[model samples]
Target: MKVAASMNRIDVNEVSKPEPDPVLVVERVSMKFNLGEQSVTAVDDVSFSVRPGEVFTVIGPSGCGKSTLFNIIGGLLGHYEGEVRIDGSKIAGSHESIGMVFQEESTFPWRNVIDNVAFPLELKGMGKSERLDRARHFIDMVGLSGFERHMPAQLSGGMRQRVAIARTLAYEPRILLMDEPFAALDEQTKLLLGEKVMEIQQRLKQTTLLITHNLSEAVQLSDRILIMTYRPGRVKRILDIKLDRPRTADVVGSEAFGRYVAEIWADLREEATRGMSDAESARR
Candidate 1:
């Protein structure tokens, strides 16, 4: 696991007070899936709130329904029970303020980098020139400045994911919902992109909710992490990360960082074991 060190870090001494308003409120949310005559609860009465400009992460075992909760928040799964509110108002369908970056590569193979990023703005009725101009800014932000015209096949996995992130940011959503966006990349690339994401979040102060299985990545990027139980997921615990700001890839070496990783691992190990046992019995 890569640890993060401080680089171009935000100055704590010059930090301004944050407003008290929460950007997202997920209240008593539950979700179930039906297959023929059988039904399974994926998430059970989960509740949490994400503060403005905060990077809040959810981590759990493979079948813990982390992705299910993310879909519910993004308004992609409307069959869910309970309320999901954004900016204090109930989310009826897909709200304009929410944006999602999935683990799967969502870049359009037919369009180049700039066009892919601008596609969202285009859908919003933005003019061609204006949308492309706006797309360039985000492309540059994700460090893909020279590759503006590169096709998705021409880029590496990491570069492709950057395009996806730039595309999401082009919409300028108030909250970013990232579901394991780095899970597909190699370790080195994953660490580099994770650092890039932290830098972007710090600079933009966009409220972000990330669902990840990587504990090290969770600790590096999150202000607080919500750990959930196995299938029929529930909030097991929410840990506040006290690490300093401007964390680079080197911070993973610190003793404090190790402790945080260890603590979360201890909690997750028990749940993972239970999930394994359940699967074994079901297979019999």
Candidate 2:
């Protein structure tokens, strides 16, 4: 995890309880990509750390390289500067300790809930009875216990996403990465799913890294939030949220939550405006 040049608010140490040693570390991470004839920087000098059993999120305007940075951390993309380490060892290209959920709908249309969740175990050549048994636990964990036989098409959008999450959890990766995994969902659904995530995290002590543009979503889910600059993304600011655990509707509706959202929105408004202006200027 990369640190911002400075934090915008919250003396993190004062607001939050002490945490265990970091589980993930991003050091001086940077990257750029070819855009037509020009090479555009996507991420620059980003550094941060995520502690064990914490939900750490990156929230920024679109085109802030959140996706690019996520890809690099998940080992999906290469040729990046710096390194990403899990448990103190550098990782590259899809380490077993890392499990990722993409922004797109990732469920296999042909497979039912059980099979989908069991797929990773199956890939590892676990016996059918054993893999399905493991899958059932995660299915229950994600609140899809009885939907084991239902096909992806039979489920609603939220259910499908739940299945996807269960599938990832079934594999039991040391760290979970979610890239705008609920961007397609409605607000109510997002909030519900978020509670589900928090519940699961509390039960499992899962260490998660999330990339989202939604301010409220970040506020609801994150223990800490990292902001990136408009483009050629750099760590702009990091803010800590001290909301009580097992966050509920009451927590979301509280004045504290509203303040967190407003603070992030204020920073995001400026960055997003810059990104839009940059896009317009480039069009000229």
Candidate 3:
């Protein structure tokens, strides 16, 4: 696969001696769930690190515990076997340094755009005027400058997601965790929002970890993608993306982009088939 020369490619050696100071570290994390008298292993021995300002993505088949792993990292679900640390500190619960935007529309229907974006700041006890000022800046940054007064009901799906992003960034979290935030949107809208997200990441330089099933999205938005195996998720591979930055929708048409997408798809196809087979057998 075509790899970016300048990108910090994660090889066996690089994994042995990672960056001197990674912004986020997820080491040997494994999770299991108990249902009545039975138990289920959701994630199995997954480990990876995201560097400062890097957009790291995790992709895998359905039921591979992508969302579960994300929750563990966000400190929403605890009691996992391994450790998750941010800035060298273990994450015990919801951390101030981590912000999350989920797949569902999280915008408050009663609040206007500016109010929604400023909610995080409100929780932090910032004065209304100061919080609104910061909120407006992020709103403008996310291309929702004129929608500051619009309510969640007034905006489209993609627009509402933008509002969520602005709100999340207002708090200035060191790391951003997105759980398929654009999965519900149309392909065109998803691509547009992906570009917008990349622009925002470039501007803020915040370490971001996105869990997406879209191969194209992974290839387009990630500096490195961690592909997982079938159910009871594990790191299958971590592939480096070579495409140059400032990426837009047009990048999808490039030959290099296609190669990266194909490579990832090739890796995932087998795992997806296996996952489907397991599901079918369980149904029987």
Candidate 4:
């Protein structure tokens, strides 16, 4: 008799547990794009590492190449010169365990919330029952319990972003790469989703790298924040958030958190402003 094919189910608990080894270790990474005869450097020699179960954030000016850095780490920007190591191995191309959420809405208008969340699982070749179960679990984790059947068009901007996160999480990735995922939402929605994301990160203890230009968002969500300089972006500072766990967006208003934010802004604001000017000139 032929035996039934048993697929391996991803256990979130196993993913939550900290790896004895570092999850991501980026060293001296740089990227350059060719526009005609001119060479454009989007990212300079930037280096950082994320340990297992860390909420690591990269923040900078709008054109400071934060997203470029994320692509390098995700193996999406391979044309760059320098090294990006995930789990101690140098990444050469698209990596399987690195799940990404872009700034744009990633949901399919045709697919319902559950289906959108299950897309990654389907791509992984998981069976219908198993993928649906995992998708539902992540949808609930992102606070979209009753709206599992709702279409992307039916959900709010924040809800759509939540679905995107659920889709990434359902893959049970070793690392999550989020590029300004909440930048398009309303302020109130951004605040709420930011807090919810932080809570989920803490509960799951996933090693995540979030790239954003929002200072408050970086402070509220990350254990460590990496600041980048303009044009050819390079690491400016790495500020460790000393505050205790389970931090909310409101924590940004606290005196201690305020001090950290102010200090980091002070260090980068001038360079960030200059970066914008450089970008404008390049456009012309």
Q: Pick the candidate with the highest TM-score.
A: 3
lDDT of each: 0.88, 0.87, 0.89, 0.83
* Candidate 1 segments exceeding 4 Å error: 1-19
TM-score of each: 0.92, 0.92, 0.94, 0.90
Candidate 4 stretches with Cα past 4 Å from truth are: 1-20, 279-284
Model 2 Cα lDDT, one tens digit per residue, 87-131: 889998998988898888999999999999999999999999999
Give the per-residue lDDT digits (tens) of candidate 4, residues 213-268. Answer: 98888878888888788877877767777767778777877886777677668868
Clashes of 3: 1
User: Which 10-residue window in model 3 sums to the lowest lDDT?
Assistant: 1-10
Separately for all candidates shown, the number of backbone clashes (residues 3 or more apart, or on different chains) is: 10, 9, 1, 0
Task: Return the lDDT, model 2, position 78.
Answer: 97
Candidate 4 vs. truth: CA RMSD?
11.3
Residue 111, candidate 4: C-alpha displacement in angstroms: 0.6
Winner on TM-score (2 vs 3): 3
Q: In model 3, what is the error at residue 244, expressed in angstroms? A: 0.5
Compared with the true structure, model 1 gives a TM-score of: 0.92
Ten contiguous residues with the weakest lDDT in model 1: 7-16
**Candidate 2 vs 3: which has more lDDT:** 3
Report RMSD (Å) for each prediction in the order shown: 6.0, 4.3, 2.2, 11.3
lDDT of 4 at 231: 77
